[model samples]
Target: MYRLFAGIEIPREIGEELQAISKKVTGASWRPIENYHITLRFMGEVDRNTAEDLDHELSLIEAKQMQLTLSGAGWFGSSEPTALWASVEADEDLTRLAERCDRAAKRVGLSLDKRKFRPHVTLAYCKGTPLQEAAAFAEKYGFLKLGPFWADRFHLYSSWSGKGPSRYVSEAEYPLT
Candidate 1:
């Protein structure tokens, strides 16, 4: 079985900007640049046949290119934190594309995500730190916009679970048509 998901790849400049901001959050564990992406769907473990079928179905989706802007910084958990993320400013094109991907995944027999989609790129996962500090940091840097870029493609990625962080590998990339 292979652990897999679908996500959008962030551009290099935006990645670098996020990387710089990540260094400011004193004790939080930052996510590596290569792992920075907004996951569209998380397709847990599956056999080779199912994976191949999912990939083929995903390739048939044709999403128009859209523009995305990283707007604010936020944390996922309330008290004991689970994640730190950069919030994406709302864009209708991005939403439509995400929904298209979600529908395509469902067509391939994967479970649909029940939660309403909110676009954000996770920057880090946190623990043992005062929540106030993280909040303050977010308040300070949240308004720093990382400009804008075109969302022209998305990818199918695979991961391997282990002792430390999971290792992710891209299986295929599907361009917006």
Candidate 2:
């Protein structure tokens, strides 16, 4: 079974800026620069045939080039603080593309995701990090702004989590017009 999702890659320049801002926080496993992306739909653990069907459905989605920006920094979870993430400011085009990815997953016979589409690029995975550290990071960089980077395409990404940070591989690319 392949673990997969549909997502947009962050521009290298903007990613570097995020990296710079996220440097102060410790006690978390930071995601590699290559792994940064805004997930559209996480279609977890499917057989080869199902992956193929989802790929075809994603390929059929028509999208135009759209701009995305990083508006702030925050962490997921409240008391436990499961993750630290950079917020992606929402765009209508971006949301529409995400909805299309959601539709593709449903078309491939996957169940609906209960969580609403909240756009974010995860920076680190927290393992018992102190709440105050996350709070401090939020206080310092919560209003951080990065870019209006152009997204020319989205990808079908395969994810694997084993030892360290999860590795994301781009299995297919769907270009925007």
Alpha-carbon local distance difference test for all models: 0.83, 0.90
Per-residue lDDT of model 2, residues 18-81, tens digit only: 7887675568888888899999999998999999999999999998899899998889888988
**What TM-scores do the predictions have?**
0.91, 0.96
Misplaced by over 4 Å in model 2 are 24-26
lDDT of 1 at 163: 71
Across residues 29-132, which tens digit of lDDT does each residue of candidate 1 receive? 88888888988787878789888988998898887887888999888878766788898899887788778777877876878788788889988888776788
Candidate 1 has which clashing residue pairs, if any? none
Candidate with best lDDT: 2
lDDT of 1: 0.83
lDDT of 1 at 158: 97
Question: What TM-score does prediction 1 earn?
Answer: 0.91
